[model samples]
Target chain A: MSGGPAGDSAIVVSDLRKSYRGRPAVAGIDLVIPRGEVFSLLGPNGAGKTTTVEILEGHRRRDSGDVRVLGVDPALGRAAWKARIGIVLQRSDDLTQAGALTVRDWARAMAACFPNSRDPDEVIELVGLADRRNARAAHLSGGQRRRLDVALGIIGRPELLFLDEPTTGFDPEARRRFWDLIADLARSGTTILLTTHYLEEAEHLADRVAVIVDGRIMEVGPPQTLGGRATAAATVRWLSPDGPRSVQTCTPAALVTDLAARFGQDVPGLAVERPSLEEVYLRMIGAPA
Target chain B: MNAAATLVRAPALLAVTRARARVEFLVFIREWISVVFTFIFPVLLLIILGSIFHGQRLPGDVDLAQYFVAGMIGAGLFGVSFQNVAIAIPIERDIGTLKRLAGTPMPRSAYFLGKMLMVAFVALAQNVLLLGIGSAFFGLDLPDTVGRWITYLWVIVLGIASCTMLGIAASGFVRNGRTAPAIMSPIAIVLQFISGVYFVFATLPNWMQTVAAIFPLKWIAQGMRSVFLPDGYQAQEPAGSWELDRVALVLAAWCVLAFLVAVRTFRWRARTDD
Candidate 1:
């Protein structure tokens, strides 16, 4: 609201740093996310994903570095600037204050705060909460409560949305539904910054993904090609007369042909497998991979 | 220019306050603990105390029941405005409700205004309940003159303003929801006792009376007594007169002082957050 909007990018950070006491949380990080992009900050717990997002959301202040979210420094975000962005904080069992308001009622109240907001009912339906419209927030399941959170976030029709581990406790079915809702929002051209530890989730929803570990960005690229997954060596395995044999090679096709030639026919129990995103992410984080 | 700025914000501010008041009222009604403590407990005490001290007369020939009716009104105002705001807000902070609202574009003033609006409604209902019960069963007399009614109205208004601000300021000291009642209730109960809401002010020890004089509750209760007690009863007061000016002065001062403290101490995030 104070400065002109940054061109082309929704978020830009240069050496963004934050620390708690004497220890660093988001140690120096740099990122640039283009407008309308669904970018995910994927990392394990304590890896600075939430800290970085919270800084971007203006919920926390940075100790140092230049950061721009929607072209305004979040530290100086005012009401007019806040109205243009939406935030979905990490799930906590702190809805005791939600009281008896039904989902529709809550959505309508939140919508009233924004200057240009989507119709509450439409946003409810968009998040698949139409059937649970009249349920009090206390009565909704964890997934439904999260849907309400998301519904409230988008009710403002934010040009930029921050989803901090939006589907942490969701079951598989609920998570799939939540992902679809996010994909719909993205297709509508809303830029989404999601933080999650779920490899499949980032792969499913993010246009580009950044793998973070210990307050640093380990890799930033498309999930399919993260850590060179597209070009990484494939492992070829087969049951030979010696029992079992395997080879890690960039040319899996050539390896398979030679194995077939040795057997003079079909190779027994032969399998060629590329590293999944999970493996690549685990390896990037220095976890057991 | 200042008026123009207010004009631009007035509509949205009023709308948000009204919406918040509606939700706050619903939440207050649903929480039976808050309702019973704020509205029901003081009236119940008045009845129980009035009956126990039935037929007893104060120095001014004021019946014990009539004396308590005035005190309970002040006590009920404190319970509804001060205790509720102090304890409820910390719980909101503890549970992240305040944190969530901070990110919204809702004007901060609207939040406090919404709370005051809700408190006004609840305090009015509390007064009707206390007065209706007092007159119906305890033979308490209602004020008969317009002047007395005016005094009654200002006492209630000033009492609520001062207490609500103090409550907001006190909320900052609460660390979490679990510990809030433990910390808030003792302070509220102690203030009521020392302020002459629970006993004869003239009978209180010298140190206690001196201490009570420094707080708003004593002035609020004394103001209520001036409105309800018969004419010429001021001889029983420590000052031997209805010091209406001093009463108004003390309460208005507390409103300003507590407001500054509240603004300085209010925390939007829960303790767990950085």
Candidate 2:
């Protein structure tokens, strides 16, 4: 196999930092995203997620950092680099200026700016906006408007895509549909950098998840294994004669077997549970209260 | 992956500019308020003012209706090129449209070129409409000589270019769409009144005329007057002559100044961006 323009990595960052008015927004952080991977950055509102993403997108100037997106330093990104990357912003208010340009009109217009662009109609269908292709941007619902954004983002056939809290206002069904669309994009070999407050969204969509807090990264790993979640102690719970009884043990299977044998019959209401990704993530970010 | 194998050829610059202009024109025409203010208001004002001054005459035997016909054309040019762009761009910024484009591979020149095309088309159409109406009903004179026609062309081109650049520069001062009209409308209306668009130049107060002379609107209206009014009417001008040289100089100077100011002040993102 051959490496890309820079290397096997689609994105590389080291000692990334940014500040506003003498206050640090993104403290030192490091990350490397391999090509064709779906990477998610999970953090609280002020935890520097947007700052980090904007730096990588070249929408912002970082105070200090060595960051490469699609094998080019984003701070020095030009037309070529921009052509290779796509961006979906967080809100639909941005589309207010779209005015009377229909979905297909906007898509075709955006496609004209890119060197390697997908067919506008195909992209519209890919984002599930085919039915509303002729509708003006203002006439679309919030979720549909976002789909148009995604459609525009991918129309350039960008190798790397940045989605900033893309599903914030989406309903459950729309979010699920969006996740499927993202999954399809990932399967087609696009590298994705997603930031979201939804833990399940990260767990569902990301090949690797990084939890950031207080301008710093706390951990980075596959969602199921983050914070040692895969190996962490599991809790067993069942009904006892007096009340509910539970115990946390590393040997959960052994404990469950022992309880069943002592009970001498099917243990009523028996259940074993491992720490979910949300639980581990909250704990890593110190959000427990 | 090989760059050549995977990369598709981008659309040509001309094609992109055309696409952008198409979008801009659609947005401009669809916004009913802008259509009313930019296109309709000037024509209506001209008709009303021409009727009010129907039987009057200036010192050069120039009919008052004819005078206002030129004034309205000048005002219409300013409105379409300057006020339209000035207000539209800030609103785009406020709505994040400019930032969205910045992230794309579209060249900055193409974007501005698209804007210029849109403004030029609107200005041309507006000039024709105002002039046709002026000639048919208001008895305004059309330039009969080639020299006067040449002067007309240069003035319109310079006036549109300078005002468009100034509009782009002025957009930077507006914080958002809500404040755009409040800021842009007053400046435009005040300039019209003080620059002889609504009244004769020599009839205005001395201080107002002086203030108006320093701006481009005065020169634009003066240029239009020189084109549409007879050669002998130059005696009525504040300068006692057409001063075609000064008209070109002032408008050209403003075009250069506006370019500089826009380069320094134009912003791609709203002030609220992080």
Candidate 3:
């Protein structure tokens, strides 16, 4: 499946501000996502990831901002603009209402939203829900419901898609399968803006990642070096006589060399490592657990 | 996109509306409780109340059965159309149906329009049931004036519009889907009681009648009674005259007011905005 016309900036936002009852949810945030890129917006819960995503999706109005999604301001986005953007809300509203409606029926119903939509069966297959295509949505498991949400979002063949904590309730196997589906979509040139609390998901799926803290972007870069995580002090751990011993230092090569000379062999359980994406993300959000 | 394509891509307003209507219709019919509450329950009330008050007298010599039957027709109209939405819409909004559809390429008006259409259809059917039962058991006569039937139709439509808007307003503030029936049932029961759904409003104290007048449910029932019942059904059925134009105008005004409130207050997402 060929993707749509690639854009240099699939989405752009400058000084976006949103408030409810005088409390700013998204307080003057800026973001840019290039076309055909899987960009993850990582944050703890209530860090404005949802608000930012909502504004970009044209689902919420901004108090003030100059923004663009697919070259049109989402605030003024008409029906045509919406057809090109798909969203998987934290909870799929369609799932509860699915009742007796089959998966195929739901897919076809969502497909009717856009001028050019994907084939229902193809979308169902991509989500790995084709086996339950005839089953009612309400009867499906949590993982199946999440897959259905993905199916509906992509059925319109959206140029830009938003997945809000899409794998929240997914099992490990289901999540891995979903990651594969997302990778396929990204490879086919769909611009994806994914907000997930799962750091591994960010590391695995995101071409670039942005960490938001208290409604502000703390850092935006590839997950490996996010906030200088890769270059930060590396930790060396080994099984010393006492038990596990660890040392933090800047020059891990020197430390390893010294260890080799002293031990005169491979230090038992020797390993050098930098901060993981989860560590960096948690530190950035100031939730060091 | 060109103008032709743009025009064709106006969010499939008709399709979404039709689908929502069909789904709601099927779901509503499939629920045995809704069927009984809307159709069967009203029929049972009609029979029991008609027999109990067959020879009861009122200030206007209006037969209690005839009076109760006419009011119930209005009540049926209000219940199926207004109460239905007041109860259902809030639940849907709390559950995220409204917000979910909002982001899609679907026009927002289609949802309410299809509901408006469904309300009209259901209200008409309920009227027929009330009239049929009234005719066979209570010996009531259908309206002879084509103008009266047309006026009755307006009353039902306007009445439902107002109630549906109130439902939207409630949905905007309500955060829990489970609390919807709990919250709306009392309002429905109160309005049904005051609108003479189970009894005549004039029997209540003068202050109660004045309070009930603020709502369109009473206006619709009183106005409809003027059409089906004799001219002097109620002494002050909208300024002491059975003017269909005035009833239409009054009900229309309530509809406009409720619509404005609904638009201003209706939250697409729930209060917590999940």
Candidate 4:
């Protein structure tokens, strides 16, 4: 694939807004996703993640704001512009309608929609669906059907790909496998924009993550440092003569040193735990749990 | 560079249209229920109705079975073109198939054209089945002369085009796949009756004739009657003459208008779209 200019952003948005029945779904928002990065938009249900992605995919119209995908305004995107992007919606079992269509047949049909597309058989294998190549799409398991969705998304060889809640119904092993597939694609320079409710997915797959809630972005950073998670205070615990003692402190390394000195060698039941990405996310969204 | 990005190219519109049509046709034929209803059910209905009033004579001495043959052909065309499309398109939308296509590079025109082509194919198959049943069992007369056959050609073509477009246009009002049959079947049955598919148009009340005249189904049925019935049979028509030119003109007008309405109203999203 011929990479475009390195400095070009795969997607850019400024002051983006959308409303439904007078209620704002995507209030004013701004985002800039550089080319060839795995960027995840993390949010709870009804957080406008889908609205933002839809506008980017040209499936929706923005009320107001400048939005560009692949250097062209998505609102004015033509066939050529659409050819450069791929979208995997939250729920699509399109081949189910063509009940007798096999996985290979579905891939081939979808491939014909694009100017350039991967070989249907190769895509089938890439999605780990080779063994079920002749199995009708309606007969595939949920995870297998999802793989087919991904296969269709990438068949056209899109420079930018949008994945909306891709792993929603996947088992843990299937989710992990899907993550690997996405990571492989990203490594090959495909710019990915992903939305999901799974924070661990964001932590594992995203090069950078944005926390969106109530149609607004709360934080944008690498998952480890999101909401100052990396530098956040850690909890230190150790067994004491009385029973146990614990303290939350920013300087956990210093506290460990002092505890070891006081205990003379080893600190019984010693454990230092830093805030996890999930904790930071839950705190940001203000969910009681 | 990613393999996908490297392979990006604009597929030819014709290729996409052809592939989509093939897939659609395959899927449609695989559904035994659709095949039976679109092609066989109408013929069965004609057989039952034809046998019931087999030897009854109309004003011009035309057999009731023969008159009903023409009427059933018109009804079959309407069912394959209008009723089928109205229900099928909404089902696709309800199931997210249309939404999926919308996100692709395939142009909307190509998608609809593919659908129209599939409907046309089904309509042709239906016409053949009905004609075969009418000729073999009911002794229904067909257009014998070249000119009459030419008239049959245009009438069937225009009838399919106009009715298919009307069905697609009406699909916009259908809430979803589940509601499509409820909304479409009754209207089709009512039109079939008022348009003289079940009885003689002249024998119907004057107001009912006027209402039926406003639609293309009546004109199509009249056109088919002109092709099959003997010359004297014009005496039984509402105008006391076989106005082939008027039939063509009205159907063509409806074809154009219905195409415009379909283009204007067809939605790519589900009913709940914002």
**Tens digits of per-residue lDDT for model 4 on B1-274?**
2445433444777888888888778778877777786667788899899899788988787888899999999999998888888988888888788888888877667777787788888878888888888888787887789999998999988898888888888998888898888889888899999998999888999999999888889999999999888989998787989888888888888878888887788888875555
Error of 2 at A13 (Å): 1.3
DockQ of predicted model 3:
0.30
Q: Per-prediction DockQ scores?
A: 0.40, 0.53, 0.30, 0.48
The window of 10 residues in a row where model 3 chain A has the poorest summed lDDT is: A1-10
Better of 1 and 2 by TM-score: 2
Identify the CAPRI category of the predicted complex in candidate 1: acceptable
Name model 2 segments beyond 4 Å from true. A1-6, A239-244, A257-268, B1-11
Q: Using lDDT as the measure, which candidate wins?
A: 2
Across A104-140, the per-residue lDDT of candidate 2 in tens digits comes to 8889888888876889999999899999999988888
TM-score of chain B of each: 0.95, 0.94, 0.88, 0.93
Clashes of each: 0, 0, 0, 5
lDDT of 4: 0.87
Q: In candidate 1, which residue ranges exceed 4 Å CA deviation?
A: A1-5, A237-247, A253-271, B1-11
Question: Model 3 in CAPRI terms: which quality?
Answer: acceptable
Q: Model 1 over residues B1-274: C-alpha lDDT tens digits?
A: 2556444533387788887887788788877889998888998898899788768888788987888888889988988999899889988887777777788777888788878988999999989988898888776888999998999999999989899999899888778878888888888899899998879888899999999999888888999889889877789888898799999999999999999999999888876577
Q: Indicate the residue-level lDDT of A32 in model 1.
A: 90
In terms of TM-score, how similar is model 1 to the real structure? 0.93
**For candidate 2, lDDT tens digit of each residue in B39-65?**
889989988998898779888889989
Candidate 3 residue-wise lDDT, A60-115, digit = tens: 77888889899998877877788888989987765766375778877876776666
Distance from true location, Cα of B244 in model 2, Å: 1.8
Task: List pairs with backbone clashes in candidate 3.
Answer: none
